[model samples]
Target chain A: MADFSTDAARALAGPVWLSDRRAYAAAEFASMPPPDATDEEWRYSAIQEFDLSEFALLSDVRGAEATPSGMGDNVLGDAGAVIRTANGRISSIEVDDELAAAGVYVGPLAASGQGSAQLGAVSADATDYFTVLNDAFAVEPLLIHVPAGVVLRKPIVVTHHLSGNRGAAFPRLVVHVGADAQAEVLDYHTSAQGSLLACPVTELDVASAGRLSYLNVQQLGTETWQFSSHLARAERDASLTASTAAFGGGYARTRSDVRLVGRGANCDLLALYFGDGNQGLDFRTYQDHVAPDTTSNLLYKGVVSDAARSIYTGLIRVRPEARGTNAFQTNRNLKLGDKAWVESVPNLEIENNDVRCSHASAVGPVDTEQQFYLESRGVRSSEAERLIVAGFLEEVLESLPVAAVRETLRHQIDAKLSQHVEHVEHVELDELVENTELGGG
Target chain B: MSTLVIEGLRARVGGQDILKGVDLSMASGEVHAVMGPNGSGKSTLAYVLAGHPNFEVLGGSVRLDDLELLDLPAWERAQAGLFLAMQYPTEVPGVALRDLLRVSVSTSNDASEIEAAMRQEAKRIGFGEKFLERSLNVDLSGGEMKRNETLQLGVLRPRFAIIDEIDSGLDFDALRMVSARVEAATKEHNMGALVITHYSRVFEQLKPDTVHVFYGGRIQQTGGADLAQELEDTGYRRWSNENG
Candidate 1:
């Protein structure tokens, strides 16, 4: 096996030149040390749960094409989508030509080379190590650009395929929504059997008066490892909404940052995760408002079973200039087994007295009364527990952008519930059933 | 005929004995009103029969339609044809009223034509289309909760029901609405009902065929509508011999 250092180095080798942006990023990443548990930002975070040697760069992606691990039609591999990385090469992407002609662009990081020059303008200085490492070693990333006043009816889906060996794969995506434009972008990551490491960084910019919705579904195998970061900026009168779900993973951490710099801008964030059996899922988020009249609302829910563990830390920050800002954050957790654990901290920092801000969090076991009620209805104990857990995750599910994705999410959640507990005969719940009583708008 | 027999039924709450030895019975197509003064065991019998967890059954036997009701759970007992219109309904937030009703009905009956049928039945019960859209009793008016309860009775079509003080906190129009739902469901479904009330106004509207006087935790007397009218006139003071 190649030395871990050399292997990490080989992935960063590009033509050396005077410009040298790629080389410079790699040198800093190699020079930087890993994050320590003592960092207050990393409290309760199991940093040691991550190791470099156990993973290898995912070279073969054939397995992902067989079936992306979702339940139904609302998943990857649809016609309008591309499975390039899952094919083990930077293959061709076939976008609906009409969409491309409408000023919408979707492609890999290298394919985004046309606008690769502008990415530097918003790129961070790499003050930390993990952020810089992703910059140095990523396969062709996804780039989406929507022109002004354009609104696309269909959402763009990006599928990242990673194979075995627990090697880290850097997956990055950059989104630019022009002024007064509306667009929805989705990122889906899947891994084959065996352990693997997938590191991802996504950056989004919503221009003045623009509206953008972003969603990410990470359904890696139980033996896979992952770390992800999302940084977003909203300009004047621009609005953004984002949702995330993690149905599978061995150990994972996702961090998101939202910066509101324009007056009258808004951002809404939601996340839901299902963790089971030796799984540890971590989530960190920040909602920072620097301009006046900015607002953001965040809600996250987690359902944990077996020996699974989860941690959530979210904050709402209002700078002094951000007067009249309103922000709210809440996290709820449901424990299906005693071995299941959750830690949630929803906090706020308001320097502006004119702003209205609130934060709340709760972590508890499945409500005994609710479970018994469903069981008494002949739903069976496991099915009853699943319904109660689903109820706890409904708010997060509500924010999912597509119908197929929502159904797949619910199906995967039900399957996970069954796997975590024995004798869990899956019973379809009536509430999730579609009906006019469910009343279509 | 479906028969409900309660023998020496005793219950307690917070370690205090509420029902000493309450015994009563009713056959199918009959509505029995258990009338008593305030603080009597009228509502306790409703809860005890439905098998609510908090109200402990100290010593009792409750058989619904010849099945041991006390041995089963609350929701299961309902599936076995016993419905309780609770005096105070539990508030379930974020659960839409329509969704709750549909799920409750579907899970109990597993009917294929339920979705369309519920829509048609919802309108006839005087609950407008919007009633299903709202959350289950959350932010609902008193009249709305009672109407929703009756709507459950209509849709679930239980063989036996216990209407617990459906008259309390209701205006004239709301009281008649509750009574009308109970009356309509009983008349249409061959249902046997035990309407528990502290005030005689609900019985006046329901016009129960049988009346049982509950005083000091026991059924002291049983008769026809004359007993309800007599209690309404004498106010249970003449039966003060068993008064606490």
Candidate 2:
């Protein structure tokens, strides 16, 4: 266990321009104690089990030539720009010259200088212990900026690869879509086999009438633990679509907050997660409507098998002044094994009488009728189960804006399903068949 | 030469007996119709033959050719050359009709031969190319669903098929269209079929070789196609009263 000190935080902040922000964040972190299970935000979480002292901050790996390997044919071919990060350090960035000349910037946050205030803004408002730690220790933060009225035809992709033992990697990404600009961004987090801690923060600011589509994929090693926070704000008439697909980590927790701060702003939140083995995946979401006529919709679906567990809690809040707001939240889970478990809670807090808000949640095993239907068509039992699970997740995946990423996610899910078939207790067809006969209409 | 033989078959659902000692046989190149009142256990018999998990076969033997089907699972029975056109097909979200057909057809046929067969079947059933891309049974009309089931029967090309209430919700044209497709495919494959229906309209097109009056969970009488017309005109009153 390594004790994270102010000096250590300063040492981890390699760029001189970012030292002041790091010192402030480090002082804040040192002043406050870590949160425990008693905190409302940490309810149902394994916060008491997480010990920050077990990991050390990742040090500067400047000039290190560790390029991302095996990215090969799977890389996004239609991406206008691709940024690769190795151990919290930017290793390579490729951008189309035409887009770059049109004021589309992709580079390290330290290069943004004073313009990087937005990078710290997200962590400053709701400063958690991990957010403060990430603020103080992030080696090199990535920044994506699109100028006013610029519409990039191709998406921008960022891949973070963490490969170290018992070390903490703090990765930060800040995106700004100027007024009336349209863009798509994808963030992929992957790690090698190791007992590492990953703390990442992302901030997205969509200006008036801007449209931004963002996707985040977490595929850390099974031995790793990850805590991620994503904050997004949309201005008047702006639209924001944010999605997540989580598939890895021993204990992965993500908190997403979307604020529709201006009139007529709209936001869509989507997520699909599958956990196998002894993994635990937790998610918390907040949809805040601050201005009139703002709308938000959230849909999250997951499947857990082989003693894996999942937790989902979401809140939709409509302020008093935010009249005519429409909001919806839904969470669905499928437990593929007898020992697998899931807990889902959806709530609505409305302060206005004119707003329309609804929330729904369900947690159950696979539908027997569906399974029987597939088997009757000559599909093997296991193959039938796989198809049902895949179909369960296809709704969320198909909603994604990127076709390429959707296909990749489907393939990854198929791989996971194939590898863990043994862990799933095959439903005894004979017993089900016998039981089914008694209920025939 | 193959036949689907059901002898002295008795079954129950939810601890209550539904089919009591049903006996029937349909050889290849023959189409049989089973007609009775609403509760005559026509659908129950069809489900039992399809190995429906809910329909328990208490005592009986079912065989297709030389294969004993009563002990096999639903999928194995399907692989053994039996098919069931469900009265009410289940809706499968996110599974496309094309994908479902591909999987079902590949069970007994080669993958290379699937596309052409699927296209031909889809066209034969009046389903356009876009219909094949939609989710299985999702938002489809009653006629479309029945046609889709017939399409499945055509694609799989089973040696024997059980059509349960295939004319229940169809309009006049839809019923004729679906029956024509089923008849064409059955004739093309020389397949044995047991068509369950209350109306004699479908029998008019199928021209079944045998018609059995079913009541009280068993076959009451057997005759030619005239029996279906007789039951349709006179109703199942005679058979129901006799069973009582």
Candidate 3:
């Protein structure tokens, strides 16, 4: 309806050399209609309110060279490589010589032409409006490939920064860990304060006996709207631990689909989201177990305060052929304000009787027992509540692979807590104090 | 003289009176044991003193060294040198024991001295480094939880302490170990204590200066340490039947 045709896709692709891929994806996007609230996948989302015609797909920015403010430093400390993109265009790429000598490729996806295979591999199975749109217009895609048996000691950090207003950006990243390889990758998304749209897609392919640790930190501007999709596939004996920290964005939604396709493959999915001040944070996850003895554990925790809202719906599906699969899904939400709302739905679809699957969900305020416990230890009521909330989120934060990034996320959570405490009423000391003249003298 | 004074304290849970007109007083460096049968308001007294919201104080006056504790919040009372070793210490997930101890001690002591004292006290309580790093009271044994509470007492060194049922659910050796630590803390800080228990065994290890028999939410009788042995031999049936 918004006229995202082949010619427009070419224009949005800018000077990128992936014309054929862009054209093919553009034709696909043109044939498919935009998702509405009626679609099962788009339920409980503000998809009906989304107007693709409101924002322009700008291929260039004026201040693309300037480093955006609030971009975290040393996010991937001691990284083997760093690739940065601004306004959907590659700004810089650097790789360690030792890693490069071991056949590790870290550079632009379009330049190497290695991303097309994995790029559409995931979205092809279950296409979404945003994924098709991203495939059609993603100008500069980043790639990180760790070759067979190459165990890189350091991670590969990728930063995507948006700088202009009233524009839409499509950022893509493809990660491939070869057989017996191990690696970690971190992606940071930040932008200047303005109304913008960001649709980012990340695809991870873990080969047999490979291990990958991936982290996505979304710190977009307060006025920005982000819709991100992440897909990961783990092969035989492969393990994938994918985590996300969503702190910023006016209306942010992330859908992650992880598939364990081979025997004994394992995946652990962890996510933390905090929304404040009329914001909305939504997440939909699918853990598809297709092979025997495969396991997936998912834990997602979030806090909503002010007039903010959050929704989490996750499903763990065990196929009929997948016996002896052990899968667990947990989603916990803390509503700090009376007006704040959260909806958590954890579902299990197990076709195999031999599989073990359990799902748990909770949405409520902080535990009063935890609050009183802290208050009894000389912590003030406000500080006590803060400590409880922090402690509630600490498990996921500490599980982060990078200490520096974890520290940064902790600081962000603290800042949000401080701001939230100002607008809410905590347990009062005067109220708890006993009256002196109630009983007879 | 520094003292903890509770005069005509009355409290109720959900409109049912639990601590009815309770009176107690103890000076610094004094150890007083309160033995009572189940449902006699022993734990309620400790919780009301700690400002637990579940217990509504109908009327009371609690003071520690001229500071009116009844008018203060739990944290303020704690800041004014009052401590409570709960009968059931809450299980706070993701909060390490070391972190809780550091914060609790820093409220009344120097920040720089917390880590060293924390490590020392943790080791003194037979807690390994891993135990100190584990979540507070999570997956801890009954004895370990009691020891952790005693460790907090050592860290805070309050002017007064209320330990409720610290000896319950502990084996003989664990009971001895925990009682020894509680005794050491009270003596080292020169603090007054109100030890609430159902058994006289803990009093034997603590060697309390006084023992009080509690029934019907009030102290029915008060006597020297021998009272503990008398109650142990006779049981609480005598006082409970008289009060009922």
Candidate 4:
């Protein structure tokens, strides 16, 4: 649609950097192009979802207020320091000034008015087009930096809300966990009821012996579209735990790119999505191990209903230098409607023979026997389906590190499911929704 | 008479005929046992009678208290007073037993007071109030889950129950507990019960008034608990051919 990446790049280049590292990173992001489905990495996922051709590069500061969506009274404080961003601009910021006192970096990218040069040094190869697109048209990237060896008891939560029709916004985030430092980042991406498009790219680096746990909550409205790219790096003895819960969006695609470049680094990538109505949810993942003795585990689950569909493709690449890498990947889909479809492909390219890797993918409807048992116990078919689907998604939600985020994810899923199921024609599932064949090779 | 009548019932599963023109009936005060060998369609009969979708009714019909059994969904059939205590009850992970019972009770239009009473009845059947709050059959021991199912059968108190192999995986004590609950559910509650099993030990505990030997997909003989004992000694091997 619009080529604002250039203008966006030029704008980011002038920002202040904590050091030379960020400025160089901004330069790298400026030179990259958005990826499309023609690219090998974007095959299974429809890169067309990112085609914000009919969307506006919303610069206007006009939008409705965003109602806080968390459970009860402000649980966002523990996400270290929390902030709320609405209509692509920062409206509220909560920072633990003490962490700032000890030289900690926690603020919005726009607030700092600094940090391009320092961010530049650590940027990886435009891993995918979305990342490049994000880098090009980036805005308000949440800025978070934990100084060396500081263990914050509370996690920092960031809420970004998208509103408006035919309007698209690019979100950017830069997080650097210092050596021997442990930090948690809670990111909530939301959209209003009107149709809007959001393209976001997040860059995270876990320094040696530093632990990073990143959670993304994407609960957009049925009219919005989403293109989110997440890139993470784990250094020697560094561990990264990341989870993405997708409960909203009309058509959404998420790319989780992880690089285990440090010796003995570990990464756990988890995702859960509930697609109802006509929503098409897609996930593209890459676990690239470039060093020896690295370990990675991935678990992704989805509940598809109405005529919704989802595609999940995960690749684990063990370079020749990356020996003794233990990798595991699994994707399980529970279809609430007979016509709901899920496609999953787990790829393993092992250049090193001393590695162990296994992957599995399964797509099926609720067990008929199980349904009968519950129904005979006097539960109606719809209520029974709800119980089974909730239980199905709970498996992944139960493992989330943060209780607040987990509960929000669960509630969002239930809300979406209830709306979708209301229109689901139980008696005519086969006729109302068509099952789309998924998986390539 | 409180009765569940199966008249000339023919059922099919995956295009294979399982229950071939099977006919039987049970009164409120009587437990009728359908004893059969493996592959004799004993369980299939039970499931079809309970409206399992996998089992298609190819011919004939089933009527419980003059209400057409084939005319309702599984849940409706249940609300109409039918219960099937399965051989292998499916475990629903993360579901609390009490939650499931409460939902079932609510769906049946049972008043809140009656629902609470059902919970008490389930508790009396063996499950402690604490255990009832746990997830329905989630990670439960085989025996514990089975007891929970029996507890459900007791609380539900159907007019017609197709209890298939309810004693298969139980020890002596568990079996007695099960039979006692079934007795209380039927004898005291005036429920017509169909107890399907291969072993007669369940009959010894539940005391069925009539026993039918099912072989080759049909009832070969109908008699009393004495018939169950006689077949227990001579297996259905020879009778299967004669009946066929």
Candidate that would win on lDDT: 2
Model 2 spans with C-alpha error above 4 angstroms? A14-17, A60-75, A422-441, B106-110
Q: Write the per-residue lDDT of candidate 4 for residues A252-314, one digit (tens) a residue.
A: 889888889999999999999988878889898889999999999999988888788899998
Better of 1 and 2 by lDDT: 2
Give Cα distance to truth, residue A358, candidate 4, Å. 1.3
Residues A1-441, model 1: lDDT tens digits: 422353454545343331255556677766777777788677777786666656655555544564465636645443344434562334457687778788677775454445565453344722355666666666455678888998877777777777756466777677889999988877777877687777887888899999988888889888877778878889999999877898777888888788899999999898999998888899999999899999999888888887889999988889999999999898888887678889898888889899989899988987655554443333444545555676667667877765457877878877786686552232234444545456773
Residue B55 alpha-carbon offset, candidate 2, angstroms: 2.7
Which of the two candidates, 1 or 3, achieves a greater lDDT against the reference? 3
Please report the TM-score between candidate 1 and the true structure: 0.88
Name the docking class for model 3: medium
What is the C-alpha local distance difference test score of candidate 2?
A: 0.85
Give the whole-model CA lDDT for all candidates, comma-separated: 0.74, 0.85, 0.85, 0.77
Candidates, ranked, DockQ:
3, 2, 4, 1
- DockQ score, prediction 4: 0.62
Q: How many residue pairs clash in each candidate?
A: 9, 8, 0, 32
Q: Rank the candidates by lDDT, best first.
A: 2, 3, 4, 1
**Can you list the residue pairs that collide in candidate 2?**
A433-B53, A436-B53, A436-B54, A437-B53, A437-B54, A437-B55, A438-B14, A438-B54
Local accuracy of candidate 2 as per-residue lDDT tens digits, B12-84: 9999999999999889978999887787789999889988888888998999988889999888998888888
What is residue A300's positional error in candidate 1, in angstroms?
1.1
Regions of candidate 4 where Cα sits further than 4 Å from its true position: A1-8, A12-34, A48-56, A62-74, A77-80, A96-104, A109-123, A336-339, A425-441, B107-139
Cα displacement (angstroms), candidate 4, residue B156, comes to 2.5
State residue A329's C-alpha deviation in candidate 3, in Å: 0.4
Cα lDDT tens digits, model 2, A103-154, are: 8989887786535566866556656888888888888888999989999889
i-RMS for every candidate: 3.8, 1.1, 1.2, 1.1
